[model samples]
Target chain A: METARISTWQFFILALGYLLGTSFFFRIGGLISIAKQDAWMIPLWSGIAGVLLVLIWIKLANYYPGNTIIQICIQVAGKGFGGFIALLYIGYFVHLSALITRNLGDFMKINLMPRTPIVVFHVMFLLVICYAVTKGVETISRSTEFLFPLVTVTFLLIFFIALSEWNWDRFQGMFHMNIWTTMKETRSLIGFPFMEAFVLMMLFPYVKSKNRIKVSFILANVVTALLLSLGVFFTIGVLGVTRASHETYSLFVIVQEMHIGTFFEHLESTIALILLIVIFIKLSISYYCAVSGLCQLFQVNNRSWLSISLILLVSGLSLGFDNILENIVFNREYYFEYMLLFAVIFPLLFLFLTWMKKGKEKRKVVGSQA
Target chain B: MIWFILFIAVALATSIFMMVKQKKSTKEIMLFSTIVLLGFADWISIFLERKFNPNHWIASFIDWISL
Candidate 1:
């Protein structure tokens, strides 16, 4: 038996890790920035696109029952070359961790600390992340199980509070833009957060019961898409296209501008804290995956050491961007392609190669039997 | 700033000490260290940048969609 056993609740909580990070926060801004007033449609279409990507993972998991992508790569390509391909995946995982961690840390700086050096937050955040990883995946899963409810409640509360400010008029001019342009912008939407469902592959192995894995995976994507769609829709409706386009914390701005019981003003700090917690959880999980993937790639018994190195590498990369503008520049031109390359293109190729190898093995077996 | 540097110095020292004393692999330490350090960079940047531009690709999707 595996040393760690995650109950159904824990798996569901763990799945939210997909939603809370780049997808929910940073990526939303990108989509809104592109789709503008028409951004709501992007998520609707992108959600469908996301479902299709998640299906690929489901089919792959079905074909290889009880095996991970790493194991499947070895089975298909054989040891030496298979290991090379696995390394590519490991590299992708690490890059993703760095990207997510950087984004989380970036958000913290913008929201919480006006004076605190970015490095301070980076060290503090990673200390917690490393500790969480060291405790292993089960501990994180259990904590997520508890924290998930609070995260959801916070989101719902914010959504409800901002509802009074909703202007149907803001959504009035939808699709006034050319359809083809909206479609092109939809690519950015599909690429950013929706395609991120591919990360489900790494987590799918841990989901209990073979039959439930695919179903649960699809359900998770649905939940994520719904939440994100609501967030973008509300944020756009309340803030209008102009403010929503450039606003970093658009939802929080909506909340701040919202009037309620007289005592409820200046609630953005609370919102910031809530987002921080969610994003931290996100970074930790991705960091853990990267570390764990590396250990598996090299056959290391201890992952803790790799976790430390990854923190430093990510920090250096994060700092290397100089400022937020530079970071955004890197993310746009470089990270966009990088996301598709890792999450979509590479995984599909792996699936195809595995299928071909399996077919060849069947033919060889039949020949021998004859 | 001094305190911050000192804290990082201490953490780095402890990490090195743990590295040598334990039979742990260098790769593992490197991975963890990169995560912490890079995570810090992210935190600092967000805190520092007040008016962060969300669009990086410089795409005119807003105009495109608005049109």
Candidate 2:
């Protein structure tokens, strides 16, 4: 299979889109509920932690220039154990993609079309994602680059407009510290939007500018952190922590409250449009990763068949969730830890083994030269 | 139920079309068939009065082991 190469800028856009995707819609309420008025600080701290994980991924990518995480695992752990680990990672990606699909389906069912069956949303969305994946990563990355700027600008516009309704007193309790609570909230943040950046490692081999991978990673993280922190800040300021925490989709509520001199009222549709774009990019990337991982795992030369099949599988799986509330609870409670295990703990272990192996090979080379 | 059937039909049609166009290997065709069949089985499980939720099962397993 010929690897599709994407420019660093496109790669950065894809990362930013992935980070802002569902997290922009769903994370604020949980963050506010946990951190209260100080929720705004969580993204900044979590973004720093995310960068450390990115550094680990970059180190591993530098070690093996053209290999995906699955290949890297096979090289590090030997074929049998490494293949098992690779399957686990593939499972994690597929599961994560299904949840994101379900989340988007549920969001639309609840907000945009209450009368429509959730499966309709899931199937239609998955069809689009399947098409995008079959076209390859360069197509997805290029589309993300074109859409990223528009989404960012619209998101910031909504943020600043919501600032009109901001009450300065919401920051009153900002300085009041709750060390344990903040730390607990930070764990979920890191487990989610931050640590989830590790999925981008699968795309590292596809990045055209190898040396600028780190720069693109850092830039994407910083921009995402700023955007998310400001989102929390605006949500708390406009709605207050109590209201923000109580609302399921706080950003939607915030956008609804934007009046724009009474002429441009009820911009929830515009907000919904933005949400759809970001979520589409995020889901497409996840679908691509999962399908591509399966191709690599199963040694399938043609991915179109598997891509369509997996799309159906994911759409079907998304319907398996009992309800939106259950989905939310599962994500906040279980999904984070599940992702952390695969994205962090396992990768770190593999990186250590790879390092030891490199050292041994280096010593052998030195001895041979002597 | 009708929607489920329609979705499955479309999926099957696409799989067949792709297999013919690309001349997919036997392994690829078999994998596609298995996935499509599994998806259909899962969809029908709802009507069979079975509470089949792989998502919840996995989540419960994770929660159990973590505990």
Candidate 3:
């Protein structure tokens, strides 16, 4: 078991940063395209469901106090099956790291560095992430204490400036979609941004205050969902649904629209920098989880080799996607379902097994006492 | 491609320098060396632009299942 412990505040900020991650930059358009004006509601509703999922995760975490989800799997499902599940999770975390890295590279290529090869950005960022992960979770979480405030203040600045461009008409037809369609659109939110918090289960054992874990996790989700919803709401109000849906980076587009008598005509780059910082924190956390999870699974005491290897692997794999469009399409069509199974369905099943095992142990104790 | 190679070299050198300074074990060194070798193999494949791409493979697997 890893002995590193982070403060509850650090864990809270880490969760918030991870939840915001690439979603801040890339996910809004998908939501707007699906829900139109009602896209903001997706996060609010999904956040409630996210809280339930977090509760289940917390229960499982408390049940296996010092063990990660990987170890929990081994304990709950037995050796062979649990190891298979753990391996699958390892793949999931690594894949998630790659996808987020690609997202960052793609965002930079499109908005900021159109001339530079995307691979360069991937390599550079992964180098930093590789270094951070080697320093362990505490270091990453401490860095977020600075980054989270910077991102929040910058995001708020963009939010307030974009208000000048908001149009009430854009919010028309809010409930035009049927219930089922609305719910379907929300799966993208729930599965991708929200359930991605499931990765935090790996870090739960590292949090100092186990008793406060559930509250911090849920609070972090609420704040992230509110921020995301506000971002989407502002995008639709400023750009309208049609324009917002068509644009890849709706927040970037909105920030580009900010104009204060020609003085602040070009703030998109500044805003993009803020988004990049938040996404970096997000990617670093996921990268750490992936590398450390592998270390735990392999029972490797020295994580330096494994961390560098996985970082290289992820950075290289991120270049596999032909372009950002293919990645977006894949996320919309398939990635959520994949994440949902592992993040939500599998955890619930694990919880059920845990309950059953506990019941059996209780019965065994009672029979012994008798 | 040259920049890619340079970046990888710098990253590996820095990582090794840190590990050695921190006195990481021999097993750790061996493992890190193996990963660096694997990274070089990947770089060669990427330079060659081979059709057997892991990225496409994973994407295709997800695509196939989602379909």
Candidate 4:
């Protein structure tokens, strides 16, 4: 008897926040480094592919309403095998949470505050996450509903503000490069930002409306893609390819230069402050899913009991990276492939079986009618 | 390290207290405590200069297979 407390609207905002969270700030430069001027278009194609990927989850979700990916896994496969698979998913989410925390900690240490111990930022953020998530998933969604509007307004405001520095000449050589080859080179992006939305399957079951759930997520994916693509487009236009590619945060580099008359100079921290909250929303979703899945696996009634432990667990793990370069290197070389099994293979098998089962049921009904 | 230990002790005490107060099953309580203790031990190990780096493990595994 699970009650759905989140509206499709909140679900859309949560998806936007979660998908864009740490990546827009941290991962954009790497994309720029690979594709140069055409980096802007990568997310668009990635968005289309992401839609196809999410469609599988949507169909599975529709087949079994009110049940999470974890529950569905346990149902479709036997308990021992399925439960073990579900546990792996939980562990994956936990690892993702740790990575997101490390991303923020690394960002802050490198760019914002160098002297403070990284653990302070990790623990502080994790503490807030622990508190919010312990209240339950609906609390996370409701808070996302409240704060997402401000993120949007600021996003738009920064967009207009950055437009003043745009130069079209930077895009001069863009059309010469082959599109198919570019896509092949930068395909890892599809995994990092788009396919990774597979994790949202955990949140999909909680959306109050069933029919239009696909629209909410597909629209969010397209919108986030557009926003991110626009971000890359503007970064190249303002800073050019070489400069944008080198900086850790190409968009933040653009923001740092936004000087409206005399008043709003050095807006990097301002943008950082907003984006850090977006990252917080992202971490909370992963944290909630991991905790909820673990609780489900263990049959623990009060999920909050595990919250404190997970904070320590994630924080400790987050500090494992000696610095940002190794983290970036790991992500570039291997993160996507590592995510392949969970994001693609498992869901495909689940949908195939469910479809087969549905077809058999339909055939049985037809025979009875005859 | 002392403060970290104290924080863990207090956290464990309160959570287990609440679990017991809510009349949760002993199995649930044990599982919760075990995870928390595991996490606490992990953190303490980090501060003691003996870190367990999962990224290393994952990366090496990926490399091992790639070869």
DockQ list for all candidates: 0.17, 0.58, 0.33, 0.65
Give the per-residue Cα lDDT of candidate 2 at A297.
Answer: 70
TM-score of each: 0.83, 0.93, 0.89, 0.93
What is the C-alpha lDDT profile of model 2 across A213-240, one tens digit per residue? 8999988888888889988888888899
Give the candidate number with the greatest lDDT: 4
Query: For model 3, how does the per-residue alpha-carbon lDDT over A30-86 read when each residue is reduced to its tens digit?
Result: 898988888888888888988988988888888889888888888889879988899
Q: Order of candidates by lDDT, top first?
A: 4, 2, 3, 1
Candidate 4 lDDT, A29-91, residue by residue in tens: 888888887788888888888888888888888888878889889988869988989998998
Which one wins by lDDT: 1 or 3? 3
Each candidate's lDDT (Cα)?
A: 0.67, 0.83, 0.82, 0.84
Candidate 3 has an interface RMSD (Å) of 3.1
In model 1, what is the error at residue A62, expressed in angstroms? Answer: 2.7
**Model 4 misses residue A168 by how many Å?**
1.4
Clashing pairs in 2: none
The TM-score of candidate 4 is: 0.93
Query: Which candidate ranks first by DockQ, i.e. highest?
Result: 4
CA RMSD of all predictions = 5.8, 2.3, 3.1, 2.3
